[model samples]
Target: MSKNLSALSFRKGVEKNVFERMVDAADKAGTAEKNDIVHQMGQDHLFGDAITLGAVSFYDFLKKENEGKKVFLCNGSACLCAGTQDKLHHTLESHFKKEEIGHICCLGRCHEGGAFQYQGKNYSGQSDAAVADLVKTGKGDSEDRYAVVSHLQPAILTAEFPGIDAYYEPFKKLIANGDRDALGADLKDSGLRGRGGAGFPLHFKWASCRAASGPVKYIVCNADEGDPGAYIDKYLMEKQPHSVLLGMMVAGWYAGAETGILYIRAEYPDSITIVNEAIEDLRSAGLLGNDILGTGFNFMLKTIKGAGAYICGEETALLASIEGQRPEVRTRPPFPTIEGLFRKPTIVNNVETLANIRAILTLGGKGYAKIGTPQSTGPKLVSLDSWFVKPGIYEVAMGTPLQTIIDLAGGFKTKVKALQIGGPLGGIVPMSHVGKLTMDFESFKYGGFMKGHAGIVSIPESMPMIEYIQHLFQFTADESCGKCFPCRLGSTRGKELIAKARTDSGFKIDRELITDLLDTMEQTSLCALGGGVPLPIKNALQHFGEELKGYFAD
Candidate 1:
């Protein structure tokens, strides 16, 4: 019999496969089965029970509260703005007990509200009849729906999805030529910035990883698309899986990495299934695995379904999660490109960023660079939320005017008060500024906003500014990884302040105190989750000050 483990033996890091095993154990466990599984995992991995439990606790889906839940309603910002979660909740409660119901942050079904997950499948349009049908027949009539549009003359990211035969051509040609230098040079010349929130130059990360000293390097595709209204990654993973895979393959080839991991979120069940299928298709086509296309170069790919921790979207935290550690943000300097994923050099790119790789290689760096602005090169995917008449994903040049994209989405369904572009962490844009702003990073930054993930969650005239602020704080408080006090405690405090102001009309928020709090959270927080939440709140205070007048004291 194995002795009770007292501490972690693997100082370097746990094996990468341990995370998937833990997730599998959690998924298969019942309410009473957790302790036994935890103990077993401890024995199997030689981790202390406390450490194992701590890692397991980071993911909300692995918690005991959700053990018996039959359905999960999306409490994402888009769904909240649509005002459908309550109705969906009530309908779900009629079938499953309140204890049997749970909530997930976002389902990437922001194009339609009333999104819910049932038995590892996602469904939207949660009408009463739909809920009833779901409960009775184990399936619902409402199918997932969204439009795909491209404004570019020759669509890049939004181009028609290709089959296996066509998918491997670019990669095969790349292998035959064996011009890794040209590949890197082309990426640099193309001026491609990461489509992920940071907008860092893609080539810099690739080059850094390539130059980093390590025996084993990793290419991690961040498919944890936790941004509430952003389904761009989801669309790419589902519709253009090959493009994403090809991108990773290119990165593997260029970076001299042999393995790639696609860290897809558990909320996106369909995306997980589709991407897994796509990986198998690639493996069969001689595009993946040992001796690829009969060349000496070998590349293998696998997927890890994130266990519902939004902070795992952060690269360091994501690396930790994959290593069977707590998904807390690690301080940078020894960045992921230097020491990541088992303390080896790792290139972590988001789904959209990886998806853009094939296009860049095919078009040549200069040619691809010509598609968008000089600063923000390449096509970007914008996710217009449910408020739009034509709510879906659109591919447009980076410098396209915000108003033009809005028009492409068929405008709002109702008179909008403001728009929350990017994710929850991005700045809130007032309706008046929409026409003045452009889609590029520089433009949005100039306008005191971020084009993060380019997801537009519209706040209608009906929703109170105070309520929206509360939502922001609540989201931050819940999603915070608790590694930094500024984010962990600050988010809770911010939420409480707003809640107090909302309930007690006589209770006025001290502006100085709030400002100091925001300043601290922004200045000292370890990662963007804490640092970035203040952007939207600060934007609200600056732009929607009048709407939030009574809540604050001068």
Candidate 2:
């Protein structure tokens, strides 16, 4: 390939502005060498100086010496549990260079034990031999077990997902009109809430960023789904990426912003490639870039892969990550709506939040509003884990009874002691109380649980509650950004106390002391990692107090 073609292909792999600068620097300096170009970027502060040289040198090596296609193996917790990471690493090393095969955090296919991305396609296998075959000849299962059961939902996500145009035709016409307030108002009427655990009104964020005084604005999709059981973002990004891209475009129009970023976790290498391809498709369709839909609304979307930080799932921390800073949560009040993404007004929505925008545009906010209950309107994507017979992503209406939803997954063959609704930080409900719950925002919250990611995980009766609580604290401690003492220290201390109680039979957990610690974390924590970490601990004490008697010293 010619130098221009090579550069163009490389540009397609990254942000447009970044690519333009790299190419410009190369041309102006009269050198196409990788080292010189990287030096220019560092000197110009385009790329951070700390790691630019190593990164650029590696890029140069990949461009010049790499002969085979890139294959990314999933080293996520799920994959690790299945022993895919170690097996696949040794297998790949046998035939391919270490640089040729890379590791991604998760592909969101936790159900599919061993997962890998080869040449932009995702495949899954359960053994080393299977993964090796996947990389060598592309022979692996691509089955993503998912179904949308919402009424006239226009296929939010599915395995046989048609492109965005087939699902939502009127969206193009709506965007051509370029009426920002109308678009924002439509979303407001849709009664859509953010799906990334917060459940905040999506339109409010859009309106705030639109009204914020700033010449430069940004729209970010937080695809950093760090929640333990939540793979809804991964499912959508890999299966129906165009939905997310179109959603971001709709958000850009509503917020009057030209640039958008999809901050996906590096754990999902397949999602990264799929979303980037979706961006290229949008540009090809002339739906992105300057003069979108002939409405003179210029918007461009880029994908930034995260370095597997759970804290980065928080919007403020996500913004910090995008800016090449430590992924730490920022204080609110000067929220992202007011100041974010390089001190500019920014709106950050999760993947599912952005995916809903197209539906709102096509069905009209009121029309879409009729699908679910008044409080939590619109369909929700719930990820059922391996505990269910038919485990996969299921899209259901908000007010569906919890039992009814569970039944759809073929119910449980054995006794389920408790159901962990939402993610790790979400509340735990005893099996007896499950029927009283409804799969909606208000119902979950009323039952001492939040519909965080709507990812339901079942706990078998054999699993002890004490161990579960310990595991939850361990997750929080590891993931907590350590920004606040309450979260960082409290989670660690809680985990240690639980461990001591488990190991040393004489070591008693002081209920009053634990309660005080939980209270402190709930009140003093800077963000959700700390504020919400107390939910499961408190819920366990309230419901499973009897089983936890051994941990409390008499």
In the range 1-554, model 1's lDDT, one tens digit per residue, is 11122113234233436678778876777331277777777677777567678888778888676688778889999999998888888877789888888899899889988898888888887678867877898876545789899999888888886677776778888987769888889999999898888899998999999999867888999999599999999899998898888899899888989989999999988888989998888767667778887877888888888888999999989988877777888878888899878777889999999988888778899989988899998899999989999999999998999999999988989989899999999989999998899899999999898889988899999999889999999999999999899999999999999999999979999999999999999999999999999999999999988889899998
Q: Scored by CA lDDT, what does every candidate get?
A: 0.86, 0.72
lDDT of 1 at 80: 95
The parts of candidate 2 lying over 4 Å away from their true place are 1-107, 112-125, 128-168
Which candidate should be chosen as best, given TM-score against the real structure?
Answer: 1
Total clashes for model 2: 2
Candidate 2, 1-554: lDDT as tens digits:
12232233333333543333532443344222356566665565445444344332222112223234366676543444334566666777786778677655446665545666666456665466666666577667665665444323455545355665675356677676657777777888999999887889988888898899978788889998767556889888987787787788777777778888898775666788878888888788777789876777899888876644677788888776555344578888888888877667889999988887777876788998998899899888888765577767788888888888888888865577877777777888888888889888889888887778877767777667887788778878867877799999999999999999999988999988999999999999999889997998898898988899989965
Stretches of candidate 1 above 4 Å error? 1-16, 31-33
Error in Å for residue 539 of model 1: 0.8
Q: How accurate is candidate 1 locally (lDDT)?
A: 0.86
TM-score of 2: 0.81
Give the distance in Å from residue 122's predicted Cα in candidate 1 to where it truly belongs: 1.0
How high is the lDDT of residue 278 in model 1? 88
